[model samples]
Structures are given as structure tokens and as C-alpha cells.
Target: MENISAAPETQIKETSFLSLNPSTLEVIGEVANTSREEIDDKIEKAQKAQKRWAARPDAERKEIILKVAEALQQNSKHLAAWITREQGKPLSGPGANFEMQACVGWTQVPASLDVPEEIVFEDETRKDILYRNPIGVVAAIAPWNWPLMIAIWQIIPSLRMGNAVVIKPSEYTTFCTQEMIKVINTVLPEDILQVITGRGEVGSYLTSHPEIGKIMFTGSIATGKKVIEASVKNMARLTLECGGNDAGIILPGFDVSKHIDQLFWAAFLNMGQTCACLKRLYVHENDYEKVVKALTDYSSHIPMGDGADEASILGPIQNKMQYDKILDLILDSEKNGADVLFRGQKPDLEGYFIPVTLIGNVDNGHRIVDEEQFGPVLPIIQYKTLEEAITKANNSENGLGASVWSDDLNEAQKVAAQLQAGTVWINQHGAIHPLVPFGGAKQSGYGVEFGIEGLKAVSLPKVISIKK
Candidate 1:
């Protein structure tokens, strides 16, 4: 453990945060509590840079952003190790390198997108056109889970569309995000893309800053509201990707035994720390026992250990706050009479590790089923009919993502269409891509994150009409 307790920053620092190895509870590094003065300076620089960066031909901007993609691919190995160590996700599997590779794909996709002006009407009598103009100085705030990839999702399109971005990553994963920005800065002008580190107050300052033209955030809904409130100062554009209690429906006659592994990972990947992960599962009454048994068998074979261990598939809960929340939900489920079908074993280690937990026979209103647990624990509820399942899945305040599974593809598609979610999947969950438009419908969020629609969200639209 690197102890900087006596460091100068610690002596004068009003506040600071630590990045720990959740698998061992060891302090991996520390992030300074950046002042409002520092944040304002960075925003000023970004605003000045945005004018020049946006003035360059779109072709020139596209080439430099593509070079960033190549740099991310080249540094995949180093990033993977840092991610695993700082964030406690696996190193080899779907952990560090997997996210890095995905960043490359996400960065490259927007570079190829076309954001051309549209002519609505052209005639001898009149002419009408719509043009997309960049919103200057975007504030990109990313969460700890999927930090690098989500940061790319936020800034890539903004930059490609000609806006400069100031990114504030979660203090827990600042190391990797800082390095990622460093790699990108090699091809970008100074302050065009900058990384700042701090706590919640710092985020509040950035959101309230008048210079920030837009704020793109991904995190809890409570914080989303705060962001919205702060943005009222400047009436800055806001795109919030908030918390989700995503539900997965296992339709009748779907072979639970066949897709059990997919179901397990869909809910448990990244120790269930993902924002769009399936937190609640609804199974047909006919297949409830089979689904439970299949999940139990699948989870028993996987191990939870230190992220550095090659054999470990799942890592710790990433932070103490999340670990404690997962524990509270499990206790509440047990008290509410939900049966524990298979509770994973807790390892004798110092890290924040919780085993894969499946609580069955859970009623609809149980806290475990209602809230976004955001951990390794999942609640499997039973539904007597397709109508009941669809109703329960769409009954949440969150409308981020949902999935319907069945052997019959048509049936799955039909049920998927009725669910009130932004992105509905047939036999899959949380598989977001760069080309598809991903956003929330109701409380989950408002604006999109990918595709042309996403590009437009970061831009201000100007319409022109002329009378002949």
C-alpha cells in the first residue's frame, strides 16, 4: 500500500478521495480535491480551444479522433492492468482489455458518422434548411463502472461534431481515465480534451459553470436531478444516463438450461456494478424452478477472488459504499420471505467480495426487486402470464433497458415492443453498440448517446428559410 498520509496535499487539502483495490481493500492511489478555481481555468481553456477545434475542417477533426482510436488500441495492455488494479474488474476476461478494445470501436464509429446539413424544402418560392452547430465546452461526467468506455461514449461524438470536452471521471477510477485522456491528448490540442479529478462538490461546480455549454452525465438519478438544477444557471444542455432497475423476462418455453450462462453474466458482469445491468429477473411460472437450478449450477463453478488472480471470473463490489448497499438488500430480501436458492460463499479475504446470490419466490414489491441493487445479488420473480410479466417489467420508474427471452423470436419481439424502455432486446440484455441510439424514455434519461440523434443532442440546431 502506498501511504501518502503525510504528503503536502494531504496536509493542506480540505478534502480528497482514495482509489482502492476492492479485492484487497488496499489503497491503490489518491485523487486531489480540485478547487473551483482549477475547474474554471480548465473550462476557460476548453472554451477557447473549442472555437479553433470546431473551425478546423470536419475532415481534420475526424483524422485526429481516429488517431486517438489507434492510440487506445496500442495501449490496451497497460490500460487493462490499471483497470483491474484500480477498479477490481478482471484482467483477462471481460475486464480491462475488453473495455479498451470496446473504446477503440466506440471512438472509431462516430468518426465515420455523417452529420450533414438537411434541406427540408427547396423551391423557386421558398427555401428551408436545418444545420447542426456544435455546443461549446461539454462537461462529460463518467461513473466508476465502465469509466473508460463510457467516457468515450460521451466525448467521441461531442468532439467529432466539433465540441471540446472537459471530463470528470469518478474518483475511484481516475487513474485509468487520466491515462486515457493523456493518450488522446497526444493527437488533440491542449485543453481540447482535459481530465479533472475531485469529489461531488467539484461536479456541482462544473455543472453550474456558465462556460459549459452542455453536460453529459451517467450515474444515479438523485445526482441527475442535481445536475439539472445546476444547469439552470446557464440553461446548459443536459443528457443524463441515470440509474436503472433493468428487468429481464424469461418467457414461457424458453430453455433456461440452454441460456443460463448468458443470463448469469447479463446480471452479474462487473460484479453487477453496471448501470444498465439486469437487476431484476422475471421468469414464467412454468420454468421458475428450472431457471433457479440452472443459475445455481452455473454460479457454483465460478470463483470470486482478487482481480489479479487469473482464475477469478468476478471481482469485488468496487467500493465500500456499494458493498454495504448490496448487503442491506440481501438482508431485506431474507426478511421479506424470499427463499435463498443458492448463496455464494464469501472468501476469507480483506477485500469487498460478495458471492453470487439468487433469491427466489420474491413478491413484486420487495425492496430487492424494486430497487436497483447494483451488485451481485439478483431477485428472480415468478409470473403466471405474459401480460403479468410485461406489466411488472414496465412498472418501474426507470425506463433504461429491458429484455424478453423466448424460443420463439416473434413472441419475444412482440413482448419487447410493449415494454416501456428505451432499448428493448430479444433474448439479450445490456448489449449497447456505438451505431445504435441508446437513451432513456421516462425517468431513466432524456437524450440519446450514440448515432446521428446523439450527435444532434450535443449540437444546437439552426434553421434557415428564404422567400424567393
Candidate 2:
């Protein structure tokens, strides 16, 4: 049975922002846009609340994070439904349940972390200590893709370390994010964790606001640059995670049937909307044809339909602008002599459904290979040498994440070490843990998230010395 919701009527007059279910192109709900005055009020409140929050005992703060996790668990079903309705990620697979589980993990793991004071020096004559200090009010700008999960990654660490956070979720997925925040707020103090909703202008205002001490933003490279520009006026500490054209390489000798599913899904998770999803693939000549045929056969079985449908493993493109961009890239790739190895069916539906497309025999310089498509399209290139594959993978401006696949572990490890990305995976891609630190290199943006280092990213340090 198809577990899907029917489209709601198009009535957008009263809402400042209308959220559409990408699978059905139906209006999910209306959201209010924040004004400059309201933004000012929230910032001021956050500033005040941060001071009180920071003064609380570490035990008290930890308990609150745990409570928030419990609340999220209780409301998982409702939140998951909202996510599927607005974001178009199928509920059964990587949709709401997956996100909620991730959220719980992010919140609990960071809450459990303890950033103890570092004893720099200790002698009879003198003692030195370094401590992690909260950086007042933080403004977190989240993206449309993986809205709640990313927000949890941002907000939980900030709050756990005793800083108040003001979150600005993408307008595309605002309502569900607002609801997620609301659920957590039942366990948090007022203004300690607040939500601000609007378009880019609101984000610019918040980033530039003198009262906001730090900014954490996740989005496109173009917008990340703009965020850096706006934060300069306030000189706020910034942690920015921008775009990534992640690459995956298959070694010459690999079992195609055993690993093809991993290769295909890693590249197309969330319908290829994930920031660290493998956008490019390089296969050694010996394994090129075998890998192509295996991957094509694997993708044929995964159905694409409304996110609400339990049988649908993938959903529609989240928005029109991205849909058009993917189409442009595909047309350009065809013009550049790329051959199509596999193309999913083009459904007779109104929503923005682009079938999973794989173009083979492409070279590195092609736009399809160089740029971050951020859609359901991947370009697979054939390389004669491992060195050539490494060079081609590192050729792009982004170095967020990359992977090396091989049946031989030693050979895969040797090549994985050479890939110039923040995180390198062998036999897998984009799999991250809370205790491990993940960030970008090169133009992918700076500042790391996750682990004790991530807690320190949202905090400042103070050194104290005692002389005897």
C-alpha cells in the first residue's frame, strides 16, 4: 500500500511563507516571517537569557539537554510526518524517522560530552589552566536539506556548553523546524533556544546584528561567502559548512555485486540533496564496466514517489530552482559527449521528480564532474591509474568528503589517505559519528563540528595562571 497524503488546496493569501510538499506540490502549511523588530527582541532576550544560562551549573544544563531529547522521542511521529510533508524525504527510509534518530543521537552525545579545563602547566612555583568559555548568544543559520538534524548539530552543542542559540531554519522547511524547536522548548528555558523565520534578508540582519556574538551557518558556497561578509561587521566567531562535490573512487579489483548498493545509495542519499553525498565517481579501467552494470541494476529496484509513501525509497526534488539547475547540468553534460548508462523512468506526475541519472565516460574538466550538482545526477569517470583518480578527485574546489572502495583493505587505506577531503571513507561514504570531528577543507568552508573540538568551536578559551 502507498503510505502517502493527498495534496492540499492552494490557498496562500494569508501566509507570509507557504511551504510546499515537493512530492505532491501541495501547500503543507503557512508560516510567519520574522520582522526586524521581532528579530531585535529575540536577540535581546537571547543575550539576557545567555547570561543566566551560562551561570547555571553544568549538571543542570546537561539535564535540560537530556529532557529535550526525551521530548523529541515522544513527539517523533508528529515531527516525522511534518518533515515528510514539507521536505519530500520518504518516511520509511531516510525521512523523518531517520532524521529524528539522528537528532536524538546528536543531542544526547553532545550533552554527554564534558569539556574539562586543560592544565597547561603545573609546578610548585606556578600553575596554568585553560578553560572553554561560552561565547554569549549564537545565531545558527540552517539549510533546507536535513534541516532538523543540522539544527540539532548546531544548537545542542551551543546550549550544552552554556550558550543561548537563535536558529534560522531555511524558509523551505521552516514549519517543521519551528515545530521541532517548539517540542524542545517545552524542556528549555525561554529565549535560551529561540527560532527566527524568514528569507535571506532576515538572515543578513541576524548575522550583522551587533548583539549576536557568534554565527554558525550551513548552506551553499555563494551564501556562505555572504554570511562571512555580513559577520565581518560584528566580528562574530563563525563556523561555516558550505557546499561539497564529494568524490568516490572504485579500485581495480572489487566485488561489484557486494558493494554496488553502497556505492549507489552513498551518492544518492536524500535524492542527492545531502551536502556530503558522493557527487562524482572515478573507476579504474579494470572495474569500470562491471561497476557500471552492477550499479545500474541496483538503482532500478528503488522506487521514487511521494515522501509519504512507505514503498518510495526516494522523493521528488525539493524545489523548482534546484530542479531547473539539475536539468541545466544534465543538458550540458549531454552536449559535452557524456553517455547515459542508466536513466530511471520519467513519471507522469506534476511534482518535481527527476529520475536518478548516471552519465559515464565523462572527463574531469566537464561541468558535471567539476561542479557540485546537489541533485539526483552523478558523473562516473574512468581512469587508468590510481594516481590519476586521486588527482581528478582532488581537482575540485570542494574537499568536504571522499571515499575509496576496494576489496583489498591495505590498498584502499593507502589511497584513502591521499584524497584531500575533510573525511575519507573506505567501503562507505558520508557516514559520520558524534564523537568524531567533521569539517571541510579548501573552499568547502572552515570550522569543524562534532566531538570535544566542536564544543570548543562554539566557545572561547580563557587562560589563568597562579604564581606562588
Candidate 3:
């Protein structure tokens, strides 16, 4: 972390820290390094505000949330550009612009969803009704990757369920989230939605605050565990979407020529910074060479450069920490005699840029194949039988998502069913819909996000019984 400078030119104060563009290392701006005192004050205010906010009619809350979506639409271009600059995702393609659109769409979808009262049991003499109620103030901890979109994922559903939110964005990408919260606050009532920006300690304070009734977090497994510990003090309800080293399996009869492009993007979308992107690929020995060759050829033509350049579809690694980690993993793989099948050419520019790379002749035990690289590197593993592929794919501690690729839908569905993941796709990887529920399994953390279940996750269920 960079220290606050007294230099007048940078205008960085002791109370705030710099936000930089990862591709250029230029200062995007400074965001407040919120103190623990400020966090406690914000949480207290949010709790007071939540009472009035939750008391409003559900229809009125829905209307206000829809207005928030409209406000986001009006400021889409400005917000998207800021996101590209601060977060290091390209402005076009499935980058910052796409993420802004997703923010609006996610907000609208949650607003439209209905968590109606349910009649769980009914008889002539007695009846029971289940109701969903707001859990008061919610603490949202968002990750740097997909910062604005993931913040939206946390904020909208909490607000839709009538809970006040105080978001603590990743220090690496704070300005974009602060900017987004600024836009959203224009349409929301005072103190209903707030952003407390800082490093990890700020988040620790916010999560541990006793006034907070629930927590919604998306980040690494290690951090999620810390959050769980913090929540224990308040006994806060938690919805944690943690790390995922998702896998994709290619069946023996898969057509590499027809689906090669989709497969490449599935793994490399957002420069493979996504939590659920295909990290490990298991290919049947019969189609191993064809799958490798097709992916290499397709990736060779894609461009990598500054996020501002419209021609560049892929951008640099978002920060120095992740960039160095990816390089070390590649070096370690090479030291262990893994074959580097294809490495893309980097743009002749200075930045935290890493070329797109694909490794072959790697097995499950290898470090590169075992851990989540979370960058522009994919390791291809070869298997002899479907059972072997399934076993190797399910061998990881992280099981957020997985996919089975084949022309035969029936066989693909069967393979999908056998995989140990929260969401399994037939031919697509990391394609999520706002209406469908998505989360992780095993060490990837618990609780679901999106749709009605997501809304319920942020709310409490109360059963009412009436005897006749």
C-alpha cells in the first residue's frame, strides 16, 4: 500500500489514499481512508435509517429501487469510463461498459422479484404463514474484480429487501465504487446506502460493528474466514461468495472447431480476473491436441493493450500483487517441466502486462493446475476416461462453478450432474443469469446470490400461526 504524501501537487491528504490506473499506474484519484470511528458512526446512522426504510411499503421500495436503475442508466458512460480507468478492464467488449449495463440490469431484476408471504401449512383448525422481513443494516464487502457490478449485486438485493447498506470496497478499486455510490445516492433517501472506503482494517471494523444485522461479501476464501470471525461477535447473518478455481471438461466427442471461440472467452473473459472463469480444463486424450491447437490459434489473434484503446480487447493485470503472483506461478510451472504451449505477444508498452498463456502436459498434482491462477493463464490437463476427468475436476477445495463441453446435450447434462459445484453449465462457463441462484460449494464459502433466494439471504424469515 502507498503512503499518503504531503506533496501539494498530488493533493493526497493524511485522511485519504491514492487510487491508480493499473494499466498506466496513473493516479485516478484519492478516496477517503475511513477510520474505525467513522465506520461506527456510519453503521449507527444506517441502523437508525433502516427502521424507517423497512417500514415503508414494499411497492414503494420497489419504485425507489427502479429509480436507482434509471439513475445508473443516465450516468452509465461516466461510471463505465471511471471503472475502466480505476479497475484496468477495457472500456469496450465485456469490460467496464458491460459491467455498468449489468449493474442496471441486476438492480432492475431484484426490484421486479417478489418475496411474497407463503402459506406453508393450512388446515381447517389452523394456518401458518411465512414472511420475509428486513434484517436492518447490512455490511457489504466487495472485491476489486468487477467492483461496481459486485457492489450492485450486494447493494440492490439488500435494498430491495429493505435493508440499509454500508459498502466497504476493495482498496485496489475504491474510486469506482465510491463514484457509483455517489450516483446511486442521488436517487436514494439519506443514509439508506453508504460507502466506507479504506483497506482491510476498515472492513474488519465495519463487519464487527454490533449495529450491523447482516453481511454480504465477495472475495478470497482467506478474507471470508476473517469476516466470519468478525460476524460471530454480533451473530450477524452472513452471505459469503468466496474463491472459486472453476474447471471445464471437454468430452471425447467434443467439437473443438465449432465451440473454440466460446471456450477461449469463457476462460479469458475480463482477462480471466473473474472468480468463476475456467481455471482448469480437463480434455479427453482423444481431443487434447485439437482443443489445445484451436484455443492457441484463436487467442493469438486477440489484442492486449491499455484499457482506453478500443482495439485492445484484453487489458493488463489489475494490480502489481496479482501480476507478480501470475508470473511466479508460470515460472514454477516451467521449473516443474510443464510445457508452455502458447504465449501471446505483449503490447510494447510499460504496465503490469502479462501475455496470454496456455500450458499443457500438466496433471492435477502440479501447482499451476491445482491453484487458481486468476489471470491470463490456463492449464490444459489430459484424461483417459470420463470418470478420470470428473474425479480430477472435483479434486479441488474450491467448487464455485464447472462446465462440461460436448455436442451431445444428454451426455453433457449427465456430466454436469456429477460435478461437485453450485452451478454447472452444459457448454458455457461462468455465464450467470440474474434470475438463477449462484454460489459456491465446499471451501468456496456458503450462501446463494441472485433471484429470490438471494433476496431471502439478506432477510429474516418469520412464521405466523393462527388457530381457528
Candidate 4:
């Protein structure tokens, strides 16, 4: 999801911005800032085209979406390259290549899902049947963190439910989204899917448009509030997935050696930019020392450098604003007496590079612990008891996801039940399956996405009753 950092500069004289490579600060490409009139025109055309598209047989729609997924696979290398350049993720590991593969995989699953009519009640005297119908048009506002994959998350389900979509991707990754849409539109009918590129104003205008029936947004809590206000204008059906300061708890008797690698990637994936990544880690005091040492040793050996380099597993922060914010948070933590267990080497190159860092001797009230840093820094807080750990983990207002680490299945499941987050992981974190429904609790936002529930989110339900 998009960071709570500064919004892209508003378009004034120039109607475009240069997309830059975060690793080298080099220009990748330029994208036009879509105007209000163009957005209106696109929405109107989508409204007209959706009727005919929705009239097509369900099997035909499914076949077409499957073809789109095939097209994405065929073009995976090219698409992965764009993602590496526009967003600062490595080409290997769980980076650009992984994201491209996920895009294809996510698209196919929604196409294969069955949304059938349901018989609610049946009797000799009366009958009731329920149908899933398409909402007129869906507006998808995507974030830069996982631009292509999240767009597919929003678009594929909407199209499967027989609705046209108009997307507004984050300015930081607009061209990358455009490239993915370019591939998708080749297999789709004209006006069935479209992307409008620009700064925040373009997204605000798109969401507030009267013609939009349902809106899907993934971004910051600050911006999510704005989306909720805009939806009030039309009372648009909304599925909002906002920012998360997710926490992970390490049980007292858990073996730190066996799961160290899994735990490392869960937090540092995408340099800890993901909304659902573990932002704060609570370790029982009994296991705190061993856990901290193991994590530091594991993180020190990992490579961090330019994304295009095959040897690098991690890359620079995607933007300068975020890079600076991370530094500020670390500095504050140190000033507040948090111990720096390990800080990775910074390559002798010019870019937004901050290596892997693990902070210890931190507590719940520390700003680094309380706020969503959204970077490669993780603060480990120690707790005296399981109750204390659970209380600390549940203290955050953002409850998108949380994890409990332990070898005891029954004990872990019991701990997971007490967590207030939307989805609790027992032994893993940030591992999302396409078939499961995923959403947040509290201010993290509501409305689930993925699986049959996701298909229903993009469509409307109607009941038909008959007198026998």
C-alpha cells in the first residue's frame, strides 16, 4: 500500500512527472497527469460499455480472463523489469519477479471461482432465490507498494462480476500499472478496463464521481479517511484496505533457530514497506536475548544494493521521503535509548539506501514501537508474561494482521484467538492465499477481499421471492 509520506507533487505547469529508479535516481519513464475532463470521459465510456460486456455469457467472460492471465505469464519478464525499475524491489527472491508471478496467479484464481445462484428457502407454499448481480462500475485506487498485483486484485474480481473498472494508480508507480493494463486490455473488450494516471487530485476526482457505484482502495489511513468522505457523496459500496502497524509475538519456549529465516523475510520483505508486514515484534523476556542475536546474525549476511544487480536481495527505499522518514525514526529510537543490535553495511553508492537494522531495548510507548515506521527497521519489545505480550501486541490501533510464533499448535491457536487483528497467523506472517478472505479490523479498514467473498464484494446481491 501507499506510504503516509508526502503525496506526489500536484501538477501545475507540467502535466506529468518523471518516474525514477530509486536505486540510481535515474529516470525510468514519464507518465501524463490525467485531467478531470479525460477522467469523466473515460467513466462515461465505461458506463456505456459495461452493459454489453455484462450481457456476455459467464463462460465467455471466464475464458477471456484466463486468456489475460496467460498473456501476463508470457510477458512476465518484461513486466518484472518495469516493476524493478519503477519500484525499488530486486529482480529475484520475493521481489519484482515474484510480484509478476503473483499477478498472473491472482488473476487465474478469480476466474476459476464460482459465484452461483443460491436457493435461500424452499417449501410447498413459497420459494426464495438469491442472485449475484454486477454493480455498474468500480473505481480502484491502487498503492505503489504492490501496484500490479493489487490492481489485479481489484480489477480481476470486478470484471469477473461483470463490472467495468477505472483505476487510479499511485503516482510513484503509474507507468508500471499502465504497462500491466496494456497487456490486460489486449484480451479485454474496449472500455471494460482503464487506468487514469496523475497525482492525488486525479484520484480524489475519480472516487467522488457520481457514476462510480463501488470503490476499492488500498492506501494510508489518512487517505482512506478521505476516500470514506468521498464515498458519502454517492454512498458507493466500498472495500477499503488501509495502513497496518501489524505486530508479531514470539512465545517464551519458541525455537528461534528453526524459524529465524521465515521471521526475517516476514518483516523485511519489500524493505518493510508492505502494509501487512510485521511492524513491531514482542518477544517474551525469557527468549528475548536468543531471538535478537539470531535475527541480527541472519540479517547481517543478506545483501542490499541496486535492484537490477542479480546479487542483491534487497534494494533502496522506493522514494526519498520514505528513506528520510526511516532515518528519522531510527535516530529517535536511538536517542530514546533503544539498543541497536545490528545495522547492515551501506554500499558505497549514491541512492536511497538504508541497510537492515534491528533495534532492541525498546518498549511499547516508544514512537518507533507505537507508530507504523514502514521501513526496514524493526523494534523488538520484551514482555514478562504471555498476557503482557498479548496486551502489548493488541495495543495498536491498526489491526490488519498479527502473528504468534511457537511450536505448540494448541497453545499457538489459543493465543491467536485472543488477538484482535483481522487474520492471525500461527507460525507464519504476511503469507496471503488467494482463496482466503483478507481484510482488516478497527481503523485498519473494513470489507474483505479475495475468494468467493471478494467476488461478492464487487457485485450486488438481490432476492426473488415467489408465491407457490
Q: Largest TM-score belongs to which candidate? A: 4
Whole-model Cα lDDT of every candidate shown, in order: 0.85, 0.87, 0.89, 0.90
What would the per-residue lDDT of candidate 2 be over residues 213-284, giving only the tens digit for each residue?
A: 899988887888877877766889989899799999988888868877788889889999999999999988
Error (Å) of candidate 4 at residue 91 is: 0.3
- Alpha-carbon shift of residue 45 in model 4 (angstroms): 1.1
Candidate 4 stretches greater than 4 Å from native: 1-14
* Per-prediction TM-score to the true structure, in the order listed: 0.96, 0.96, 0.96, 0.97
Error of 2 at 297 (Å): 0.5
Model 2 scores worst on lDDT over the 10 consecutive residues at 1-10
Q: For candidate 1, lDDT tens digit of each residue in 1-468?
A: 001111112222456767788888888777887786788788889989999999999998889889999998988888878888888898756777788899999999899888898999999899999999999999988888888899999989999989999998887788888888888888898889977787776677777777889999998877787778878877899898986889999988898777777888889988888878888899988888889889999999888888888888888887888889889989988987889989898878899989999998796789998889999999999989889988999889999999888899988888998999999887778888888999987788789989888889999999899898
Candidate 4 vs. true structure, TM-score: 0.97
Ranked candidates (lDDT, high to low): 4, 3, 2, 1
Clashing pairs in 3: none
The true-versus-predicted C-alpha distance at residue 331 of model 2, in Å, is: 0.9
Candidate 3's residue-wise lDDT over 172-216, tens digit each?
Answer: 999888889999999998999988887666777777777889988
The C-alpha stretches of model 3 lying farther than 4 A from their native spots are: 1-15
